[model samples]
Target: MDIEIFPYRVLGSDTTEALLNDLESLEDVKRTVIHGPRFPKGEATLPPKYRERRVININGEDVVLQVKTARIFLEITMESTIDEIEEICKEHIPYGFDINQDRSNYIRKQQTVTDRIKYGDKELPDELVGMTDQYSTFDDHVKIIKKDD
Candidate 1:
């Protein structure tokens, strides 16, 4: 089942990076995506600290964080793995977070008309199926991490 992790406060770049690194390390975790409000594009007049994009290191890879972390959607097979995830969140997310399991469709389950039009006759991997909304692009919202082979 898919689980949604809602943090009490909006997470910054550093916290998001740390939390995602730990969550991606879990064996039971199949896929994970962070969803949140996008930072404004025009920040020229603002100070550097208020800059929208931040480069965060994940598993030694640098990823540009474009939004503040609002909710994390995780796809997992084992229910017990939620405990481990909670432990990780507790360590990094001092503000607190709630894990919701009641929702049946946290992630999309079927392909839409856009998907059909985007890649006609081509098949999309299961991991890429429901990662983004119809209006948004994958790179704008979805971040895919695979375990080492």
Candidate 2:
């Protein structure tokens, strides 16, 4: 099951960071993909505090956010988790947000023609099937955060 968190306005780095931390804490929220316009690469046009690509701590790992956080796609374990996710969004997205449950598949589970072109015949792991845009290299976009004992 999957749910899409669509905020009325683009979310900043701090909101994205806090929202991700909260959502990821839920066991039912299996996987997440944050989608938005890519931040421009170069000297910071905005002040340091307003920068969009700032590094954020998810769990314990610090990962740099590359997108402006227009929409957040969460893959959950069951349909019941939708309400729980809604509550979380209610608290985080004050400007207004929608919990879209209608989308049958927010996260892609199958490989496409683009995937074939990017990866050839080499098999890809299930978790990485649609985590990235075909135009971008996998390493540049995908960051798998694993905890250490």
Candidate 3:
């Protein structure tokens, strides 16, 4: 059993409210919270002042635009695998949006490599390695050749 955190940001408040309402209707979404610097328990936080403030020229007058930032926090339980979790999230969330997994010990381990073979280093023995059927030698190493017509 593994726990995964999914973060989503909806630009407008209307969209955020709609998404939250949809999630609340689902039983699988156990808990949802807004995250922000001011309110740690909230589901989302206001956009930073720097980002919210913008200057634009409108009709010979300078207009300042303030944009609000908000995000939703979903704590999901993964019984199958990370790929399965991502699929579920994609199915629920809309297109052109971003979804990211929260930082965890498992992710850290997978991302950080303790030992890496540098250029010109001796390749590991084949007996100690496992071949993956999904990959092809030709796909792994592609050569650019000119065609002589």
Clashes of each: 0, 0, 7
**Number of the top-ranking candidate, with TM-score as the measure:** 2
> Model 2 Cα displacement at 52 (Å)?
1.8
Which is superior by TM-score, 1 or 3?
A: 1
TM-scores for every candidate against the unseen true structure: 0.88, 0.90, 0.33
Tell me the alpha-carbon RMSD of every candidate.
1.9, 1.9, 20.4
**Candidate 2 residue-wise lDDT, 17-128, digit = tens:** 9999988888777788999999987638778875778789999888888889999998887988888788888899988998887978989899988778888888988887
Number of the top-ranking candidate, with lDDT as the measure: 2
Query: How do all the candidates rank in terms of TM-score, highest first?
Result: 2, 1, 3
Clashes of 1: 0
Which regions of candidate 3 are displaced past 4 Å? 1-10, 36-69, 79-95, 105-149
Tell me the spans in candidate 2 whose CA falls farther than 4 Å from its real position: 147-149
TM-score of 2: 0.90
